[model samples]
Target: MLEQLSSVFFDEANELLDNLESQLLTLGDNPNDSETIAAVFRAMHTIKGSAAMFGFTDISSFTHEAESAMDQVRNGVIPVTGELIDLLLKARDHIRNLLDAGAEVPENYKQVSEQLIIAFKIYVSKNGGNASLNQPVKKDVPKIKKEDKLSFSWRIKFRPSKNIMKNGTRPELLIKELTEMGTATVVPFYHALAPLSEIDSELCYFSWDVILTTGKSENDIKDVFIFLDDESKVEIEKIDLLPGENNRIGEILVDRKDVSREELDKILKEHRQLGVILVDKNMVSEEQVQSALAEQQHLKSLTPGGQVATPQSPASTQTLRISSAKLDQLVDLVGELVTFNARLEQEAQEKNIAVFKSLSEQCGRVVVLMRDVSMGLRMVPVSTLFSRFRRTVHDLAAQLGKHIEMATVGAETELDKTVIEKLNDPLLHLVRNSVDHGIEMPEDRVAAGKTSVGTVTLSAKHAGAFIMITVKDDGKGLDRDVIRAKGIQRGLISENDNLSDNEIYNLIFQPGFSTAKSVTSISGRGVGLDVVKKDISTLSGTVSIETEKGMGTTFILKIPLTLAIIDGMLVTIDNAKYVVPLNAISECIAYSMPAEEKGQRFVTTTNHGKPLNCINLREFFNFGKEPPAKQEILSVYDGDEVYGLVVDKILGSQQTVIKPLGPLYGNCVGINSSSILGDGSVALILDVYQLTGLIKNSSKKAS
Candidate 1:
């Protein structure tokens, strides 16, 4: 159980670290951004609490110091500074290292942790921002006007996580912690407990309703719940009672939201004590009425004869955190359902039964809809990727002594989680390239008549079934001559090869290719762009560049939205089936390329216009059988290049659940994955980019 919870803790810890990095970068820019500041504090606080709970004492102790500094920063006792931000950022990385290192942290790492702890401690030590090793946490207490220091009354509903006891949390410790503030009456609710045989010793079945009279504000009370996870229910409300003998029970029940106002009014019509009526009518649980009565009695004592209930509002919709592994399992099940539906259609066709055919069609629609929803569950906003690179840009800028900022557009564009995961390395490389090489330094930028701060824009948007992600920078663009020289020096291309400017730029992706004058800490070693190419290609994607000599460069990646499924246009070549992504095809024509107008690897229309790079599927794959009398031409595109894919015949569209061809066909060109046909035969999914490689550059396109 500890092992399982530790896994969840690490996952959550990583997410919090990502959030922390992003928030810290934001706070670095806008020092007075209170919300971001508080977010950093909350993240640190949660990590500290969770780490302490999980027995990661070193991590808990280390993060506590950072949290203390942040708390003082939160209280406005300490100011945000670049040095402080730098310290916190280092601390964040240390926490991540600790999490990654697992149960044990090394002695040297402990020293590093202590170093950061001291730095955070000293950074906030000035102006009583917690200089001491044992400074008590100061709550944001409200000043009471009454003679009694404990002038505020609060109702706290706390339900510990079911596994809290298993995790070794003591409820008495919590209650004891709470009593430090002032008076707290904790009424334990055991109504949720089952009979002895049914109860699990490891599980916690208790909740509490605490009526506390204190001068502390809501924030102060919230601090007591640092032990709880986000899913735990902890509602804190302040009581504003008035002095009166006629303090209404029905009002208290309604305000507590244990009973609706309508139910209270309706129950009052019977007037046999509102609590008893509510419990007997089953308007609320007996425990709820008793808790309301507890509040009623507590408030009456405060006001000498009255109890006032604070108004409660509906809570936000809850979100469940299911691991991606479960989502993948669901999608795999959906894929099976799709295959099963296809089998139904095939059986219906073979029998030529009208009823079965109708049923198959209905089931097919349902499967397609269900498939869409299941896949949609895996589609997350690209902002998750975009926000992550902000730190990359921030750190690189500081390292390189450049003024750089990130701008994003269409961040809400969604893509499959698998694609997004694979995209991380490629995106990281591109973003680093943009910062290291693409974005010019401040002085150089000013001299070049651009802004002092270079901007790297990361944007993503949907284009049909593909997602187009652009990493653009406002900096000195690629020097084609330098790239050409590097390509020649590396033997990737000869000097007399006469490469186009675009081709010259693409040579940067060649292994061992570099335009850097010398090796540096970042990109000068000549290995980043090739990774971008290799990764994007594995996803059956393509990359292209757009640049102007003095302006900037943009690396555009066009990748399929999902690897699991596609609305493919199935085609036939030599009686063998293939699936072309329907979204990739512009149109299909029923005319062959005029033999006389055909170039080496391209074909021209009847009008004999510019040649379109064409790949004859039959000839490209060298199929045994010949094509039919008539052939079809699929006008498709890769990036901005228009191309034609020639096929024997179009077999219409299919809901293709793309399956990997496995290692045997891993090296196969023009085919990346396969889909199961209705009759249970495998149809290869055509990769347009790979097929484009089969088509040599045409004279018409070059000119």
Candidate 2:
């Protein structure tokens, strides 16, 4: 166990570092949270111990200072302070760099470690120092236990993850590590092994069953597989009975899951070989019987043991950690299945077969259920993404000499993991903007009759099939006149242009559009908000601003829950088909083409006494044929107001698995994506927000 595998150690060490950072951030939130304080100590201690065991001497040596400092916090020798958190955060990052870049010590890393060591010593001296850290800086050598003189028997089952080989592990190395501990009888299981032609060299499908008689403790054996804890399954049973003890064959067979207890009992009553009887009864195969026999023989080889071992306990786990890459692949396969199910249903209707139709209906129902479950798998809580900003807010507030706190609401709101990843930059930009621009200086805030401590609130709530993420700041709002002047100065607008207040607020999203006289790191580069607009646009989401003259400003982002698939209202104009997102639609109403709209891009009509701006789909895209005198108006809400999207006909609703148009048509106005219909026709998905906003603005400016 003391001889460590490099790949395994690095994987686990990096994870510990990430956990260490998160726990430290939580401590920053509630300095008096004793639970968090203890957790931080544990993480630091584990990292230091594991690093020493794995021969990461540099990490172990540097981490010793951090560990002792945290020990001081745990023992109530010192209180947690912002300075302490900052020092530890820097230490965490430094250790991560060491792990990432390997043994090559960069100049900056050396400087950081030296500085951090000095600070850790300060904290240590403040608590009168710890004697334990006085030990020599070297890899920890496990001391021989008293049990090293006493022999015991163990049965170990090592079922490694199939993708273990991808981590550069040689399976034989594990066996070697175990054999070094004692006399081992190893049997390889190739049940999952593929044929040579179909074999994947990158994947490991082999597993091992070992019966070892040794003086080593069970903990030593467990430590050998500690790095594989999440990626592999290991079961070690202390079965120290001597040869010919208590129907060991049946027990071995049962333990291997090759035979059930009831089946074994029934066969044992017949007084024949349990394995043979089971194979005769067609219960387990001859191969399984052989595997069980090997295990039984290995147990017999345990020379007249010292003490009998109790039965192994059942394993219990509440949760499992999985790779995001695997989840993405699973979702891709499910998307294909969903499309195939639609094709099956369509074929059934076309062929007019009753039995086939029934089968298709059942399959369709199952696929729908699977679609829901698969999509749900990607729905991670927003809290994980939000929690990361605590340190950023803390450091930025300190840097700017401002007193601010980031308050989060609806942190439990869920969204697609992919969307959340893309959303990070946009949110980061908005937050930085709020801190640097929206929030005023302490004196200025008091002059404005507001609290000195500014608050930036991040909130999310479900809006139909969409989720609205709002970032609001309780500080000086966007000045309408200042923005207007800036817009005109930057040639983003004209003095002659009669724009609404909302339109003026949106001027910030334009590239290189800023009202600031100078730029800083937080904001005023003029690129952050522009990048926000473009990135959100790619996800088929929209951003809007709500600002009062003296009140604080709020930036609201309305995004679809999952971008992979959507419930769409399929509509057709002449020979072309288009899908309008169901979430954007309010209601569909029949409309007669007016004589005044003969050559117009949009027709202003009335709905419930409100002027509804309607866009004619056929005329806008210009198809081969003319639209019917009677057209259909789909009321589309673009987060601001409801506009009418006039189409030829409405063809109900269906699940649309979105396929991106890629860069070729990325900027092709209005069309967000395309989907394959059940009939194998490609239907374009309309960007309701973009279509309404782009065309509405164009129509207004034209008039």
Q: Tell me the TM-score of model 1.
A: 0.73
What root-mean-square deviation over C-alphas does model 2 reach? 17.2
lDDT against true structure, model 2: 0.80
| Model 1 agreement with the true structure over 1-703: per-residue lDDT tens digits | 9898988888889999999998998999999997899789889989989998999988888888888788778767789998998888899999999988877788889999878777777777764665864465754553223443445777788888887876667766777777777666678899879899999988888888888877677888888777676556888887665433355777776677777777667777885876777777777888887787777676665543222333334442355678999999999998888888878888998999999999999998999999999999999999998998998898999999999999999999999999999999999999999899899889998999888999999999876657999999988999988887777777888867976777888988887677778898897788999999999988878898999988999999988999897889988888789999898888887866555633333555531466565777776677745456688888886655667888889988878898977767778888888999878898989988667655645533655
User: Per-residue lDDT of 29-95 in model 2, one digit per residue for the tens?
Assistant: 7998878887787777787787787777778888887877776676566678888888889888888
Residue 503 CA displacement from its true place in model 1, Å: 1.2
Error of 1 at 300 (Å): 20
lDDT to native, each model: 0.81, 0.80
- Give the Å error, residue 341, model 1: 2.9
